[model samples]
Target: MAEIAVVAISVAKPGHEELLREALEGIVGPTRKEAGVLQYDLHRDVQEPRRFVFVERWESQDALAAHAQSAHIQAYKKAAADWIEHAEIRVVSKIA
Candidate 1:
């Protein structure tokens, strides 16, 4: 099966940029250690400080499903609920 790539974009609520970034950063270490994680990277927008993105690759759809249900991800959702203003997640497969 082909690998799955995910791009997750998050925007922090006005004054909560720092808190959102910290919360997002906290999950990186643990997420990378997951069974089917191939790559996991976090990036901040140069022009928009409150915007953050996650670039991730997983071995398969099942792996990605597991990631979604992981405890750390669940915790992050709860922790950043009030701090985040918007979030968009996309999963795609490479064509070439």
Candidate 2:
């Protein structure tokens, strides 16, 4: 199966930027250790400090699905729910 790339964008609620950031950062180390995870990186917007993006690459769609079900991800979702105002995830395929 072809690899999959995911772009996850999260917007923190006002006054909760640092809290959200910390929660997001906590997932990085554990997520990177998961099977089939090619890359897992987090980025914060320079102008919009409350916005965070996670760029991830997986070996396959199944791998990505497994990642979604992982404990760390579930924990992140629960922990971030209160602090995040908006969240979006896009799974894309490479064209070139």
Candidate 3:
């Protein structure tokens, strides 16, 4: 089966960019060490400093589901909830 690809985007509320970034960054190390993580990268928008993105690849749907329920992920979500202006997450497959 093809790896699962996920793109998660978040925009920080004004004045909370740094906090949001910190919250997002806190998950990288732990996530990278997860059982089925093929790749997990975080990026900040060059033109829009307040925006953050995570590009991730998982071995399967179950892996992704496990990731979503991870303690770190839940903590990040809770910590950044008030600081986020908008959020979007997409799961896709690479066909190219």
| Model 1 C-alpha lDDT per residue in residues 3-67, reported as the tens digit of each score | 99999999999999999999999999999999999999999999999999999999999999999
Candidate 2 lDDT: 0.96
Q: Model 1, which residues run further than 4 Å from truth?
A: none
Model 3 per-residue lDDT at 81 = 95
TM-score of each: 0.98, 0.98, 0.96
Report the C-alpha lDDT of model 3 over 59-81, residue by residue, as the tens digit.
Answer: 99899999999999998888889
- Tens digit of lDDT per residue, candidate 2, span 1-96? 999899999999999999999999999999999999999999999999999999999999999999999999999998889999999999999999
Off by over 4 Å in 3: none
For each candidate in the order shown, give its overall lDDT on alpha carbons: 0.96, 0.96, 0.94
RMSD of each: 0.6, 0.5, 0.8
lDDT of 1: 0.96
Pairs that clash in candidate 2: none
Q: Give model 2's TM-score versus the native structure.
A: 0.98
Kindly provide the TM-score of model 1 when superposed on the true structure, using C-alpha atoms: 0.98
